[model samples]
Target: MTDLDAIPDDPSALRAALLAMRAELAAERALRRGLEDRNERLQHFIRQLQRMQFGRRSEALDPDQLNLALEDLEQAVAEADAEAEKADPPRREARARERRQNRGTLPGHLPRIEVVIEPPTTICPCCSGAMHIIGEDRSERLDVIPMRWQVIVTRRPKYGCRACGSAVVQAPAPPRLIEGGLPTERLVAHVLVAKYADHAPLYRQAQMLARQGIALDRSTLASWVGTAAAELKPLWRLLRDDLLGSAKLFVDETPAPVLDPGRGRTKTSWFWAIARDDRPWGGADPPAVVFTYAPGRGHAHAATLLKDFRGILQTDAYAAYKAVAGAAGDEAAAGSADGGVLLAHCWAHCRRRFYEVAQKRPAPIAHEALRRIAALYEIEAEIRGRPACERRAVRQARTKPLLDAMRPWLEQCRAQLSKKSPLGEAIGYPLNQWEGLTLFLDDGRIEIDSNVIERSMRPIALNRKNALFAGHDLGAENWAVLASLIETCKWHAVNPEAWLADVLARLVSGWPNRRLAELTPWAWKAEQDALHRAAA
Candidate 1:
């Protein structure tokens, strides 16, 4: 029976029955809304899965490929337009005049080659007289020259004295990178740059050389790489020391695969990267990065890599890093000037968790968290490149209040969620690392994320992708050594090829070990700049 049928006839009883019916209706509406919300979330989750499985693999074409396709299309259109204009003389005249007027000049740095075109005869068509030059329209297009291989020959002559006959004199030959071997230091540098910086494997380089009829074996190229890496190890150590000496740095690691010949399979390794870029705060230190390869990713590995490093270490919320921070807490508590490392966690990581939740389902809490984090990053953008003191003051004045409100709000939201829920876990991440996440408010030198070191890992990733796996642990270590110097050169905007070429030559000439700092990318760039200014 309906509730109305069970109602009493008395006036007060009827009013109570109506109230009971209204309460039941409201409860039913709430339950229906909850079910609808859950259904909507499930729908979104399914759609996300479907998209992942069936969508285009990549969001966009590779930049280089896109540019090449555009170049071809532009050329084809130009050719077609030219043919059309040629079929009509008046259109040809109009188009030629417009094209010449609209043409852009190439860069001035490129060497210019001039070509002069003249009529069949140097006489005017109207009269049999010589034509004089008028204002000439000039246009420029870019060009390229293919790589050329050459050999250098050195000879030392000896002469015996006529009277003495025992005395002989000869000049000493210049130093060679490969003793009694064919390749020069410059060639070795090229191989290093191509393999490490350009991500071309030794076998591919050997094939390229073979195409040119050089016919060098892959093992020979590998030996040259190993030799160069041995010579460059000291520079890599110096770079590591230079970065560790800084008070603040970014540290991160990525997996590297090495072939396990005994098992005929691959084993996972790690490349630990430490980097510093103080340009954002107007600090004078030039940017640098050094990568160290380890057999495993463990707390012990991090401790060894950052053994003497003290001060702010920015990184993702990896437990290994947290372990390092915990170990250093003792010295920090003692108030030592060179205290243990203070962990400054990445906000990007925190935001990423929320982003994943929001993308998969209807998550107002995650979305709100992301919006608030974005506001903090916005303030960072405005204060970038300002003095550290000013940055600190601005963060304290502006960013602190937002973070202050966000902390309690996040806690309150998490209280309403089940701990096992995706949104709950997203909220828990930042809360777990609250201290490290908020540490940036006190120090201006620290970045909001460890993207500096993360950026340095991309080349390593590319090399791994191309080469598949390193032969063994030792080969992986060599990869670390060369990658360190090559990436540092790139950070300083120094041409890796040119810097490696010059430094390899100097090392072969027995450059002083104590003065290895002079050969670092930044120092070498400074010296080059000074010479250029003097010449100017």
Candidate 2:
């Protein structure tokens, strides 16, 4: 080989060298662009995901509730084929089974009923005589209670003063739950309680009430709700103050339909809830739950609810909440639109959306996230009904630090992922929604998510689905009243029907104003405790 041959290169060789360099650089640039896009997307997705999942609903429920949601979602997914999006034959069979047992208020335990006679013998317990069977035994199950109509009669008597030769009627009775109205206070209470606390609607209630021969026209029933609600306006305000005044408050909003009178359009109203238990902050009161009706579900609604409220405000990612709070500092506006509110985010909700997507695709990244979330839930489950302060300690010790470690891992997953993809939905959703999701860490009283509000919303949802819309402002307000009271009762573990019937039955004219409060669930509960103590 000549030295000239090694040194000299043909034009072809030089051209090939140039081409290789260009191709190598091009590949490197392309790889760099892919990494950058992945990082950007992951960042955005995480921020958005962090906003809120189911908000207050998931956090407020007991572990069993989460289990129930998991069960429902599992059954829902199993029966459903994403591509076909239809139930398989087996799924259809399961659907029938579910429907048969679809009563509401999902009983915590199956009741054991004792009968005097054995089932095989259709004999009467009183006579022990063989009796012809009227029909087959029938059973209907529901997610909660199935209401039936109950009539309560109140009679105020007239007494004549014969000795004085004067005729005087016993004072006209104090206003009933429905003063001179169609439905009894108990009936109105039942409707409000069912619709708001249980999420059953008035139309369904009309049907339910009809079963018991309480021929309530939906309009007439609506009128009674309006009237009864109007009477309780003062009470609602008092309750609202009680809730907002608490140091720890959880807030959430769900859409409610209000009838548009002139256009007949169903306007969306906001059903906002604020709940807090004094167990953490104040010792005396049980958990106080309050529901407020707003014209719209904007920041304004939330602002009004939390105005002048100094405490922890737990909410999800509606953007409106932060904006409204942010605007509170701008002094240029009319005397602060609303006072400052400290907001805490929810974790359970953010995790849930990811969990759903993870269900569809269990990639390594998603699986890891699932494992982390499961750990948090396990902590919450262990102390199911624990006090707020203890819960805070457990979460602070367990959840806060777990989330701190998870952040870097989440960022890494985001970098390797595509933004518009399913993985993006799972990963990015929580990341984007991070601020609110993390807000809870700072406040001991604020929940991990707004599950309590969501639980509160379910009762309203059931009622809305069945009844459809509130007829008028007064009608909606009445809904706020009864729902607020009954839900509070449910929150504190009191039966609303029992309280309302007893309160309404005792509305005597001469009774002192303070005595009337005994009808309220809190007061009624106090009275019950007193009675129980006496018996004990």
Best by lDDT: 1
**Candidate 1 residues 403-429, lDDT tens each?**
999999999999999988999899999
* RMSD of model 2 against the true structure: 30.1
Number of colliding residue pairs in each model: 0, 49
lDDT of 1: 0.75
lDDT (Cα) of model 2:
0.58
Which stretches of model 2 miss by more than 4 angstroms? 1-219, 261-264, 278-285, 328-340, 383-397, 433-435, 503-520
Question: Candidate 1: where is the Cα deviation over 4 Å?
Answer: 1-146, 159-166, 332-337
Worst 10 residues of 1 by lDDT: 67-76
